[model samples]
Each structure stands twice: as structure tokens, then as C-alpha cells.
Target: MNEVYFPYFDPDFDKLPERINGPTCRVCIDNESMDDCTVVKVDSVNKQGLLLEVVQVLTDLNLIISKSYISSDAVWFMDVFHVKDEHGNKLTDQKVINYIKQAIGTTRETHNSAKAKTYANMVFSPEPNNNNEHTVIEMSGTDRPGLFSELSAALADLHCNVVEAHAWSHNDRLACIAYISDQSTHTPIEDPNRLASIEDHLTTVLRATITPTPTTNQPNQQEAKTADFLGGEGAVTNVERRLHQLMHSVRDFEGPPSRTASLPTTPSDSESDEEAGMKTTVKIESCDEKGYSIVNINCKDRPRLMFDTVCTLTDMQYVIFHASINSDGGYAFQEYFIRHLDGCAMSTECEKERVIKCLEAAIERRVCEGVRLELCADNRVGLLSDITRVLRENGLTVVRADVETQGEKAINAFYVRDMSGNKVDMEFIESMKKEMGPIALQVKNDTIRPSSPERSRFSLSHMLKASGSLITLLLSSNPCKYS
Candidate 1:
């Protein structure tokens, strides 16, 4: 009569109203349990990507997830997250808590009634239209040192200004989203001819030398093409989420390295273990009794790491059944129990390996290896172009970039290295600060870790072809559950 389950969720979850007929969400916040962080518990009817949606709500608000637990199986689901503000203190702001409820704790009768879309069905149609004040440009292709600079220059020449932009590169694949407007009128370009022209120019830049021979009709062999979806800025699709989709569309996890090889050379086992030491360790195994594939990961802690991992799993069509997240001693330890959307555990060795490859690629995509620079200046029509041109001319390569606008000011962050993949010269960086004005351009993370900068290099193709497997050990034991 006293028996108890070790990893407990909500025992009364089955009795919640509308548990069987519709999606119901109940989110509770407890601030007294932990002094350093607030504990958030969410119980709801399960759906595909439900975990990702919850995580996205918290991450978008810039809250830090210190630890958490997740369980979603059969008809019900429950998740607990220990969270803190950016200052590492438990959340105390009432306004932020209310917003989190509005965002993640709403019932979804509509979602319960509608069928979920498959990966193929989710691709944005390439049709061009004038639907918003700015034009949305989506692209994916092989990344090069100055590809962004080239694209910015081309757009500038076409009388378009990039007002907001995000670019991500992984495994030599580049995924970019830019909201552009007319340079002169500062509005969406409506002329059919101009839109056509812009698409053509971007396709050329993306395809340059990577286009396949004229004989292939296969979708997998198709070169990168511009997909124009004119829309308001971040109104419908989450821009960052779409970036993940774009990279997966191009099959970045399996493709060969591009000519320029955005990632540095993979180190040989004999070269040094330092580079491998920094790798995000991943292991996947199946629990047949529970019908779930458990994934365990250990890695150096970083911002948004959980979001990136969960995003990959969701995009890969895996549903999380249970999870535990913790961070200590500057390292992250996470375990996820998941299964395919159809409710089957992964069965094949190949399947497990693919999951590992995809997870590793996902984790490394956001890890930049060079000096991070932040630029703040008054917004201008061709501001992005000017900044990118400066980087290109200075022999620097932007591995990652985040561009946004606030009020009348332009705020941009760039992760840059030399044309060759190595630590940047401080003297050159100082010169750049002087050129761009010291107060306007500041070095945020100037001290790049030199011990194993190559660990930041991630090209799935290179990782496989070089050593034939990932650097992480594959453990067979399940990670211990959080108390």
C-alpha cells in the first residue's frame, strides 16, 4: 500500500476536465521550493511538438532554464521547469509570469480538431506575393566566408534594404531569413519584374558553383533556390524555428562539405583529444518495455542549448515522452525519453546513429568559435550592407549573425573569425573598433577559448568521413531521474 513511483508526474492528470476530448493546459508556478529559481509545472493533453512549444515560450522571453523534467505519454503530459531571470535570480516579476501563462497555458480546442502537417507539407510555397510592408527572403545553400556580404551587396544593388535578418550555418550549409524593403521608398517591392529579378539574383548567388549537372530531376540533388514568402516580421512563423526547418530541408546533416568548408578541418584522433573533449556527448538507446527511445546528452552549458536540442527532435518527428534537464559545474546533463510520432521506438542501429548525428549537428550549429562583436548605431537604409562589406574587406568571416532594430537604432551581433578558421587577431579587431567608432562597435566575447577552437567546427559530412563516427561515447545505461 505504500509503494511509490520514483519519477513522479501529476497523479490526478487523468481526472482533469477535457483530458480526452480536447487539449487542456494548466500551468502553475511555485516560487518557494527553490531559493535560486522558480519551479513551473505544466499539465496538458499531449500533442506533437507540444514540448517544443512550451520551451519556445520560455526561451523567447529570455528566461534561463536551470533544471526541468518532462513526461508526456498515453493521453496526458506534464512538465516541470526550474527557471531564473537573466540575472540568475528566481523570477519575481508578475508581468512576465502573466505573459508566460497567456503564451503557454492556453487550451487548444482547435489544435485537437486539426490534423498535424508532415514535414513535406510544412515547406513554404515558393510563390511570390506582396502581403506585407517588407519582403521575406528565405534561402539555404552551401556557406562560404563572405556569402552574407555578397548577398547584402547584391540586395543593396537591387535597391533593397535588409531591415531584419538572421543567418545560421552548420555542416557547410547556410540558412538565412531576411526582411527587406525598398531602399528608396522603404516599402515592399510590388513590381512583379523586381521580385522576379531579386529571386533570380539570389538563386545565382546561392548556386554559384554548387549547382548540379543539368540531368538531375531528383529533389535531393536540386540546388538551393530562393523561396519568397512575403509576410509581416515574425507575425506567424517563428523566424528562428523556420531557420531550423530550412537547414533540415537542405539535408545539412548528411551532405558533403562545401568547397569552402565553413567548418574547420576535423582533427585526427592522434592530433589531440582537446578538440574532441569539448564535443556535445550524445547517446541513444531503446526501452522496449516503455516503447521509447531514450536519448542522453552531456555538454558544456550554453544559452538556448535545450531549445536547440528539442527543436531538432521535434523536427525529426520524435515526441518526447519523458525528460530530465540539469546543469551543474558548468556542464549540462539532459535525458529525453522519446518515440516516433506514430508511437514506435527506434528499432534500427542506423536509426539510432542518425539521431546522434542530427542531435550533434543541432547542438553545434549555434556554437560560434570566434570573437563576438556587437554593433549599435542609428538605423539606416544600407546599414547591414555597410557592416558586412567592412567585415569582408577586413578579411573576416561571419560564422553567425543576429540583426535587429529597436526604435531608431540598429542592434547587430556578429561572430567572426579570420578567413581561415582560427582565432582573430586582436590588433585587427582593435582597428575595426577604431574604424567603426569605439563607442558604436564593442567587443563582447573577445577572449575565444584557444585550447580546442576546432571543436566548434561542425560539418556532419566531414565528421563522418574523417573519423567515421562522432567523438562522444555511447553509454547504454539510462541517466538517473531528477528527485
Candidate 2:
């Protein structure tokens, strides 16, 4: 069997192996699959962000959370997410579990089969309710970006009052504790048809499976806890009874549309008849201090278009920091983190705006004419070879080079300056731009050419090295290279 599929094997084939098992849900025992995984102690403080991050990952993977809980601060919040094949059988495949563990940030720790299973089962136990006051919905799964925002928006539109909400992330998985009450209970949720419609909508919005807890005959601590979890139901009677019964059913909320109709066409997708553009990444080193901000204006992805982003620090205004940029087709993407010196207050408001304007102008200058073309391609070993050969063969001296890769494509920019410190001929640049356009190429000449020897000597070797390394990383990946 392929290594990634080894974990799905059923051991012993006797009693139904415990539906769940593992120490912390993040620690997966499977070396192959991440089909159904768990994360542990997610309810603790300082771990909430981790849960959101995990949810973001799961949303990306198309997996859904099945069970979750929020323990008191002293207790760890345990969460479980399941992976099912097309046939609907639980898949314990090691490969799927490992992918999930990595996706949810849990693979770093030791795996405990029994503990993971126990925690999953604990949350998955049927939640039964006989009364009707509030509903407790527990969500858990791999984390992904925009998952929370979408869920919150749907709930707001549904008129469901979210009285209590606690979210946590541990091991890259996300779990949320939500106590929802129908404020317009005048038309209570007693009607089955109404309940089913709302339930189905919730499933679509969350992109995860949903289950209901069964209401018990006798009142129990869990019921009171559920009521308290819903923040006392406010002047409503029988809150406990209502919460108990509502908890029985589980509802999955799917994510946003895979491809929204409203999404703007990216530069890479534009036709050749569209405008041309140049994309570049800039690195700045400055002290982290008060009153610094980065901003961009009219920057969009396109051939010959301006791709701009900024980095400024407010706490340590005078602290030193560095930044860099990268591009895809005609679009530019940037990643920069700032740090502050000891005991520095954030930058003041005025200083923040100044930094933003500076970075924005710095980038806009190159693309002022507009982007003529843009494309995305993988970064291959021969990328630099092709660039330099083209420049040298065309008699264009490459005074400096800045290169970056997004997905498979290598973005290269040649700051060509003649030996006399004058800029390369505009006609030559235009010709080169035209030739490179078919292969996702761009060219920019700073209107004011650099004449000083210092300008010519400063090679972007370090920046290129950093960007190049990322392209060389060859792990098991889907390699979605978006321009």
C-alpha cells in the first residue's frame, strides 16, 4: 500500500474499533491519511486563535467538524473532525489523518489513540433535549480563512441571537462553542418544517455536517450548563428544557461558493488585448516605533499595472525593519513582518500615514504607465539562465536583478543600467517586454536612471536567494499556482 494510505487499515477487525482515538486531536496516529482527526485542549485561553486557524484549514480541505466542547478554563477543550469517503464510511487512513493533522496544526505533538477517541466520543454523544429555550451548537474542524466571517454573517441574517461564543485553535484545528437562541420565539421552533429549513441552511453556510443532541427525561447538570452557556435565556422560562432537546441534532455548515460569481477577474485571466503591467516586491528595513503605517492605492493585478502593499510599525517607530515583494502575472503579492526595539511605543497617527504613502509611491512609480501583460508560472532551475541570457543577448546590461516565485512561476525584474549610468533604451525595453509577454514577463525602467556606481553595484542577490528557495521546496503538494 502507498505510505499515505497505511493508516486506514482496520486493526483486529473485531469490535468496531472505537470511532475515535488519539491523545490530543492534533496528534494523529496515522502516518497516511487525515480522514477524521481530533484536537485537544482547544478551550483554554491563548488557544482560541488556533481553533480559528484550524477551521480555516479544514474549510480549505473540505472536511467538517463533527463534535467539539469548551471546558472550563482549567480543562482543555477537545474537538473532533471526521473524514468520510464517497460511500460514507469513516476513513481512518493514516495519510488522510496526517494531512488533517498538518492542516489543523496538530501533527507536531505525540499521538494518543485512546485519548483522542475518548474526547471525540465525549463530544459526539447524542445531545438530547426535551425543553425549548436555546440551542447549543458545537463546531470543529480544520481551519481556513474567511470561515468565521461567513458563519457570523449567516447567523446575523438568520436572526439568531448568539448569546455566548467561544472559539479556540489547537494543533491547527478550530472549534467554536456557540449558544444560539431564537429571539422571535413567539413563533417557536416547535414546527418540524421550519426547523428542517433552518437546519439545512446552516449546513450549507458552514460546509460542515450538523448533529442534534437528544433531550433527556430528567434535568441534569449538562442541561443547566447549556442554559448558562446560552446566557440565562433572559426572561424566558424553560431555557434548560429547550437547550437539552435542541442539542441533539448536528448541522454542518458548508463554506462559501467555490467560485463566486462576483469575484473580479484576476490579471492572469485577462486577455492579451488587455493592458500590460509590472509586479515587484520591495524590502524595507526600519525600526518598529509609534506612528507608522503602510498603504496602497489603485494597485491591482495586471500587465504593466501597479501592485502595491506596505509595512509600517507604530510601537517602535525608530526600530529597524526590512520588507520584500513578489508577483504573479501582472499582480503583486507581498509578505513583510515588522519588529520593534525595546520599550518603543507604536507610531503616532501622522507617522503611520507617512509610511503608508512612502511605500505606495515607491511601488506606483514603476507601474505608472499601466500593466500591459501578466501571467503565473512555476519557478524552475533554468529561470535565471533564461533571464540573463535574454538580457545579455539583447545587449541589455543587467545592473541588478530581483526575482520571486508564486506557485510555479518565477517573477524576474532586471534593473538594466548602461555602463555610463544612463538607463537602457526605451525601445529596447519595449521590445523585451513584448517578447517576454507570452511567458508572463514584465519590464520597468525607473524614469530617473541611476548614475552612481553604488546604485549599479547593489545586487539583489540575497532577495533572489530567499525567493528561489521557496520554489525549490518539493513536498507532497497540490501546487495550486495562482498568478
Candidate 3:
């Protein structure tokens, strides 16, 4: 009889002891295979703290988490750790299955991330002229920890050169297109069987597709770098470098780049534009579920432009806070709130309107800038039922919904709307609230107060005329005078 030796994780192992002290540990149970790494979905009421704790736990386990993606739905963390099998072979495994179950019980948490959010409605096609010079893989599913890196590692093991890749996560579902070519040998990965095997391996670990030949080489290198970073060394720094270049491209607001829609050929009169620049706030209210709602403000020099920019937040229902007019005669500042009653879906009209509005305000165009959107809400039965009624009566569609709460306060955020611009009445808002009670209050200036009934009319009407959903929260004006 032959005896086999195996290496297991030391329960008391302490490398980064500070990371896994006490309740702050991300421990995975019952996973030993390299290909079948498990993902534990931890949805503690304390999501943020729980996420931090999980990170610490992985660190304590001496595992290297490649990416920790946070979005409106849930926190997705991807990691890799060196593990020794019975044969003493170092291997990489995705610890997603049982690990998630061990931490959060058997209940499967929703898979939503900025990367793989667009799981549905995405069309993948094979890149033409593939006479064996390239291999394309369009993989998208729930964004899990190490999905990309593990795939890249598998590719590396097979000695493939990644030529192009693009990926984005909306609600933790990831969609990615990767183009690969055989190592310097440049061997054509043209075998259908080979392609199927690759896809099978990817599906096993990533739970994503491995399609052959898709879309011409409109390769977004930034996405490739992101995938690389999530997969291994020097990727994060490289991504940071590119981000720095993008930042330098814009002259102001070293913050993330703002979305700018193409300017209309028939521009408004110069004098009128200047007047639009003078207005400090553009309050927009639209009918959602209850009365109406407000979105965000674009503080660029043009108030009208900010108004148009409201189309971008079409996904969420919110109320307008204020869009500060900039002194530069361009779009300067913008703010808005996601409302409880506004419809749950957005229209193309809203998207275009917001884009045009932002352009009017003076936001410059750039490549690969951060997309700004917000969803803040805790789960509350009373608030949701109220908002739901308004949405149904108006025939507004809900594209996305998430309820997240921090501290003791609850925030309910929804993206919805009437795409065809159906008329939503005030009676509907009133009736909905009467049945479900008052809409939840938004916290402002560190003080929280319920929205008044009259205010709902103003808030809702303003939201109806709006284009984008208001995701950016307006920081309360400082009442503290400077010394």
C-alpha cells in the first residue's frame, strides 16, 4: 500500500495576525479542490463591517484576495491562497461555494457587482477573420472573488497571451470579453474541442462563458488591466497609473471623471446659456410611485444643462437637492436625492437629457472615467409598499432595486420610470402613501426629518421633469463659519 501526504491550513497559523483577530475572520470550510473554490456570501446587517472582517479573515488565512468590489447590492471579494495538496503541489482554487455557505449559512446571497451586473440582454458575437490567430472568451456571471485571476492563471498555465479584454459589474454580475492568442508560438486556438475545454474550465471556476470569436477588436485596454490587476502582480499599480493619466486629462476636480453627453448641434443662445449659468439650483420633480421625486443637480455653469443631465440617473428614484451654478459660467455643481415614490425604471429620454444637460454645464469628455450613481436604502416594508404603488399606476418599469442600511437608519433606493412618459397623477401618490404610510425620511446635515406631504408634491413633480436619477448626495452646507 502507498501512503500519500497532504498539507492542510493550520488553524492557529498567524501571518497577518492583526487581520484576523476575534470576530473578524473570513473562514472557509469543506473546500479542497483547486477548481472548485467556494464563495461565502456574508450578509450581516453590518455589511460594511462584515466585509472588513472577512477581508481580515482571509488575510489571517494567508490567502491573497485579488479584488474586493463593493456595489449597491453586496460586497464581492476575490482572493487566491497557496495551498498544498496531497501530492504537495501548489494550486489555486476559488473558495466560493461552501465558504459562502459556512459564513452566511446555506442561503445564497444575490450576485450583484459593478463587473458582472449586466448578465441579461448582453449579446456576444465571434470576432470575424478568425482564421486561427485569436481566441475570444465572453464570460459574464455573478462577480465572485478570483474569477478573473483564476481564469488568467489557467490561461497562463496554458501559455496564452491576453490581447484584449473588457469587463464591467453592475449588480455583482460580471460580463467580460477576453481575447487570447497562443504564446509566442502564436498557435491558432482554432480547435472547437480546445475552445470547448477552455470554456468548460472557465465555467467550472468562474461560472461564466467561454465563447469563441466575438466582436471585432474594439478592445478596451483599461478593462484588460483591471482584469490583470484582479488576477495578479503590478496590475493595481498599472491601473492606478492609467487612472492618473485620465485624471490629468481633466483640468479640474481631480475626482472621478463626470459623464458628458454630446452637445446638441442646435445650441441655445449664448445669453440664455449665461442666464442658465447664474441659477444656483435646478429643482426637478417627477412622478414615481408616491406623488413625484427629485433627482440630482449638475452644478456646471448651465442650470439647464444640469437639468438635462438628470436623464443619467433614470435607474433610481430620487429628489433634487440642488444644482449649484458655477462662477466659471460652466456647469459647476450638482446634487439630488433618490426619492421613494419615483418610478423604478428610466427612459432613453432621461439618459439623453442628462447627457445633453451635463455637456451644457461644461463637463469635459474623457476615456474610462468613473460612473457616478447611488442607491442608499435599508429594507423597510412600509416604505417599499408605498413606492411600489406609484410605480405600478404610472406603468413605470423597475430596472434595478436594492435596500441597504447603515447604522440605525434605513435607506431604500430604486431605479424606475415610465419609458413612454405616461402621466402620473397626484391622487395616486396620495393614495399610495395613505395605504403604506409616509415615505422614509432622508438624512440631511446630520439631522434627519420626515419629508412633508406638501414637499412630496414639489419633490415628485420635480422628479417627473428630470432625466437622470439623483445618486450623489448633497453635502449639507456648512453652518459653521470659518474662523
Instruction: Give the winner by TM-score.
Output: 1
Which portions of model 1 miss their true places by more than 4 Å?
1-23, 107-131, 211-235, 255-276, 436-483
TM-score of each: 0.77, 0.22, 0.23
Query: What order do candidates take by TM-score, descending?
Result: 1, 3, 2
lDDT of 2: 0.34
lDDT of each model, Cα atoms only? 0.68, 0.34, 0.33
lDDT of 1 by residue, 421-474 (tens): 656765554443343322333344334333322322223223222433222111
Per-residue lDDT of candidate 2, residues 1-483 (tens digit): 655644565665543422333333433332134444433223222232233333333333333333223221222434333333323445445555555555444422312111110010011212223224546555444333334334445555666544433332222223444555564652233455654655556556555432233563422211111223331213122221121223221111112122342122244233233343432334333344432222323333422121112111221133222222333344545433333334333346654444444444333323211222221234544334433443444444332222333345554433333333233454444443343332222333234333333321222233234455322211111111111
Candidate number of the best lDDT: 1
Report the Cα RMSD per candidate: 13.8, 28.8, 23.5
The parts of candidate 3 lying over 4 Å away from their true place are 1-133, 169-171, 208-483
Candidate 1 vs candidate 2, lDDT winner: 1
